[model samples]
Target: MSAGWIYNFPFEININLKAIDDAVRAFSVKYEAFFKVITKSLGGLVNSINFVLNKIPWFVLILLVFIVIWRTSNKISKGIIFSSLLFLVGVAGLWNLMNETLSIIIASVVISLLFGFPIGILISTSNRLNKAVRPILDTMQTMPVFVYLIPALLFFGLGKPPAVIATTIYAIVPIIRLTNHGIRQINAEVVEASLAFGSTKLQSLIKVQIPQALPTIMTGVNQTLMMAMAMVVTTSMIGATGLGMEVLIGVNRIEIGRGLVSGSAVVIMAVILDRATQGLVQRSEVKTDGQ
Candidate 1:
């Protein structure tokens, strides 16, 4: 025994890996069309993001983001801080790579929200679904990220599509879990009162439950974005392009400076994104508390 155990008489545990491979292969062939559809959608998004990021000059992109940040924040200081972070990204001489990384993260988060939000709503409404999905989400969250790439590669082949799909899968759990938690946490008394007042189920959900849950959901969104960013970088092993590639190359070559700089850039982006979304969470909390 590999473990050098004394229980050698237990019979050979020969699990046929070939059967699993054949099953997956057959499944992929049957669902090839569906896979292609997903591929086109994700590919188009990646292409669009890459094109715009490439076309836009660094200064203009930074300035535009700064303007939006300033307007949203209602504070020049916040905008300046975000802009400075952008400048750091630019100065790393890896703007294009960073842009590629950002594009994947954005695409993954958008996809996560599109799917996770509705599923979360469904889970919140149905106890059976909540029980069924909780274990799935827990497993997804607990599994090593590297494990995701295997099936992702099988489905999407390689490059950006697999990366995006893998990223969306890995990052989506927080949004679904937190959104469910948030909605479920809403006071039962409040829901009962809303229903008693002749509000339809849909109306109560739209007007009360969702509004009350927005802050917690946004917290989920924040976490999802962070996880997406982290995974997008990690997905470079399967042909993803971005800061992850830089880090990967550094690792392969044992170039300490290259890896550190690329890693630091990822950190800076994470911090900025975290802070911006944090502001949203704070505002949402304040509104909820005020009411």
Candidate 2:
């Protein structure tokens, strides 16, 4: 009465997953030089944040951030709200975790911009490259984010580096896509006019394209930041410490109060970052108005 034969494979596949894993481990060991370069880059970024956190008193850092956000936002109320939320994280006793989360976001965004912008520019220049890369970017954007952690852990090992490597991969697509779109969307007439002035390609790009694309680029950055935070809690599975870990521990212990408070602090951070970046985009538009 049970037809199990229809559902099962006809033969045993005998795939050696353990061997595959060992091969990957051997590869990482064999290429330590290549690995070290990336490790240093990731380490430097995370370490710089710890350096700042160690040197600055928490209250002083809050004041400084308030001043910068207030001035950049061009709104005192927005600054006050941001500062108050930052303080609330401390009151919630998640200040250290918040710092870890913030550092991770900043580091991932930095690396995203570092690689993504140049690759975007390269793609924008060639229809062939654009055609080839678009599908890859789509895959990177759509893949289950958790899938990144396996290779990330294999190559970078755990703790901050793999967490960052995973996050950077997860968050990088938006910047590349948006930057390429922004550059390509510029008026053909403007580009032609710049060349008519006998400008070299690099000159035209630096003087015209990037300035015009600033708003869109900033928007990509904002999206990347949000995406990075979205992954923070999940990345904690691989030795990351932050608001993510706080939530993880809370869940394991059935501590709903802890989970809610830590999660809310993350939301507050997201809002402040979102609003601040939006202000930058608006300002960029104003600057580009006449051009």
Candidate 3:
């Protein structure tokens, strides 16, 4: 009976295959055009940014980072922590690679915010859309990071763009989810008071909700940055040149030291970003409380 059922299942399988084939054929042109536009535009934008940023001397960049640390955290201890990571990256001779990695991470994080935050806002405004987007966010968040590489490579063809594409997809989810969560969690009384005070919908959202929710949203951004860093390493498999590539090379050549060094560099980067962003979020919360 089992064998007979298996034989009959081939018809159902064929039907499913045919449906998939038809769908792919129907959307192939649309997908191709979309991919071309995104990959080309994003690739060009990142390359241009890299060109300008790369021209700045490393010393200047280091000084700027330290300045940012001091201004944001307002503490010598935090500045030292930030400086130490930069120093290690320089000493590892992975400075350039780390910069490239940073470039990609920055690009992805910026784009993710540009795109994710709006979707989050939109979802927050509509229960129907929120319901619709929830499952998609679940899938994006839950899917294994490596699984995205296949379709990403298929569409963007293995380079910084593809890696960025993959990284953006993986990293964007946290921001979207958190933004929605934050907006939804805004104090109802505050919202009501704003509405009572002749606040327009936009004004209420901007003044009351967003200001109150900024800390939570920033937390989401922090998570997005961490996830982006992780994806950058995975993306190196597809010709993303960075510390990730170093780790990939080490693995391929069975050089444990190379992998360990690159892996540590990535960890350092993650820690620095996480701490900096967390500090910023904390500062924002404090400011909001003071107000």
Candidate 4:
């Protein structure tokens, strides 16, 4: 080959590729250890919660959700929603699967909130950090959901932990972006007024900025919950059992009835969650504006 040809650059490219692979291998080892420790700790807490919920009668759980919805929204909507969920569960004949799906959704949301909110707050306070993180969040949001499954499988190896990890990544971007946007959009006059009143930065953030921004933040949370539900269903391809497994099995085995039932189950679950979370956001907005 001519020395001037692109193929003549093989030796240099080979060294670069090897270096990149070595770095990736090192990161994988560290990531695996970190993932294991965190998942184990959280897995215990999830199992404890699941055990408690399992002991409750399904009817009771449904009733509790109804009461929560009514308290947060209103009675009429709650009644309609409760009936719809009940009908869906009965028709799908997958009450247990629904519960399991609910459990995973709950766990993922809780974890996302716990981690996401603080990160959001931090990013909101620092413009430099926000600029740095914006591109990363964009990448996370735009990347194929299936691509997440590959690294998730490598790190956590195909189970609820991997499922939760993927769901969390897929669902977390909204909250961070919204929280940053909400805080940044706070009126300059309001912040100045707080400072004039001798409020500390922390005090201003908590008492003034956060209260005003609550609606936007809540909207972000609503979106996150919906995305989590969708991603969790997709995670079924990797052995995380739920409605997703039913759908996956149906597709693989060419069982039309199975696919329809499971797909409907997912749709029902999505609708219920979407309405509930959006209701919460609307209520929050009303209250914020009212105040």
Candidate 5:
């Protein structure tokens, strides 16, 4: 009848989470060579993207931004504004750092799309698979972002490779969820009509389903990109260099001004990406609706 006894469970059930950790670590060690190959490949990819971003003339990059935003939104003013925001990062002398961060984001998002989109499509086609995968997607999305870093670090060590891998895992859920939802939400009649018109399953899926689902899928892309951006500071903890690293360094040194500047740059980049991608989503929606 005591309050403690009433409120707390009497059973002392325990789960040996350490055993799971040990098992994973052992598996990673057993497949060390395979992991090394993956790490090397990812490292090469990150370096290549960083190199390409760095090689572009600052003005030309800005111009490219202008073009992208202008075309997507059909508004020159918004393009100019966002382009100016990007320029300020350069003016603040964080251009190279920005590129490094962008490289990681681009790599993570590309990888996420490559894997997640197809998996989403496959799951959407089958109820059994969809049920099986939904729980996994839910767990992945709800799991601590920090937790992804552990496996990544174990496999790839401390570098951009691990950062890319961790960031991809953290960001992939939105695309998969959105892709699945987009496909499933399409009108049944449309699919039936395509099949009735002598279309094979693959043809209907590619020609009709995908096009109809594209806008929602684009929303997922936007969300995934944003999530990838969110991981920048977190990924920096594992020695990934960029604006996030700058922020980390500033925090360690207790340099308020340095942290603030880098943090602002991160915000600016996020805003630019969000707006640009949202613009594309809006255009896609318009096109879909018009059709």
Candidate 6:
């Protein structure tokens, strides 16, 4: 009759997640040397990108962006509007911070493509590997983004390296999943016909499978880029410097204006990237269809 008996009829079990954490920590420490090399390499890459971005004259970079937008979209008005939005970030005094954010994103997306595309190809060729990797990708995508920061911090420590590591982990899934999906979605008959016509496995994959899958793969790239951008603010928690850091500072200091402006800059950049990438994807699909 007691409320406890009626409402709390349950058993308690505890999982030793701390033990897993401890194991990871121990492993990280045990292989600290290797990790340091990776950390240093990644830091260098981010710095190189940041330096290049920062060195570009503001007007020149804006013009480049306008050109890209114009070419991809085939719309002069959209190019003008997007370029103006980018210029507004400079007007708001966040251009340098935006560049820093772009540095991190470019580095992360580059690394993601380097690893994800090949793994995706391998997995697509083998059902067993696909089955094995599918659940792992699910875990990665479903796992809280915050959890990625932990391993990243342990492996690479603070600043751009860890930021890149965490962002890459979060963003890479889409490309891998989509690459495999895209390739697998190809017609088996098409692949077989290529083989029958003296196309080597490598040739078929390179020419037929990849070209056909390009649109889907490009979609994955767009998603990966977006996810990397989404991580910018989160990575700021670990000392990443960028528009994200500005937002964090504003939040901590309760400066509504600062946070709002920085957040808006981030949005503007994201919108430009998303639209441009989608336009390219559509163009690729049209080209592929026409072929």
Better model by lDDT: candidate 2 vs candidate 6: 6
Over the stretch 13-94, how does candidate 5's per-residue lDDT look in tens digits? 6889999899999999999999999999999999999999999999998888888998988899988998998999999999
Q: What is the lDDT for 159 in model 4?
A: 68
Model 2: per-residue Cα lDDT over 1-291, one tens digit each:
767778986568899999988998899889978987887788788979866876778899779768878988888887888999989988988888888888888888888889999998889999999999999999988999888888787788778888898888888988998889889999999999999999999999999998888889888888888888888888998878889888888898999999899999889888878877777877788888954
Backbone clashes, each candidate? 0, 0, 0, 0, 0, 0
Clashes of 2: 0
Model 1, which residues run further than 4 Å from truth?
A: 1-9, 64-79
Deviating ranges (above 4 Å) for candidate 4: 1-33, 70-78
Positional deviation of residue 77's Cα in model 5 after best superposition, in angstroms: 1.7
| lDDT on C-alpha atoms for all candidate structures | 0.88, 0.86, 0.86, 0.80, 0.94, 0.93
> Please, what is the TM-score per model?
0.91, 0.89, 0.89, 0.86, 0.95, 0.95
Ordered by lDDT, highest first, the candidates read 5, 6, 1, 2, 3, 4
Displacement of residue 133 (Cα, Å) in model 6 is 0.6
Per-residue lDDT tens digits of candidate 6, residues 1-291? 556865775666798999999999999999999999999999999999999999999999889879989988888888899999999999999999999999999999999999999999999999999999999989888889889888888888989999999898889999999999999999899989999999989999998999999899999999999999999999999889999999999999999999999999999999988988998899889878985
The residue ranges of model 2 lying beyond 4 angstroms of the native Cα positions read: 1-22
> Model 5: which ten-residue window has the lowest total lDDT?
1-10
Write model 4 residue lDDT over 108-189, tens digit each, in one string: 8888888888789899989899999999999999999998887677767766777888888988888888887888898999
Candidate 2, pairs of clashing residues: none
The CA root-mean-square deviation of candidate 1, after full C-alpha superposition on the true structure, stands at 2.8
Candidate 6 scores a C-alpha RMSD against the true structure in Å of 1.8
Predicted structure 2, TM vs. truth:
0.89
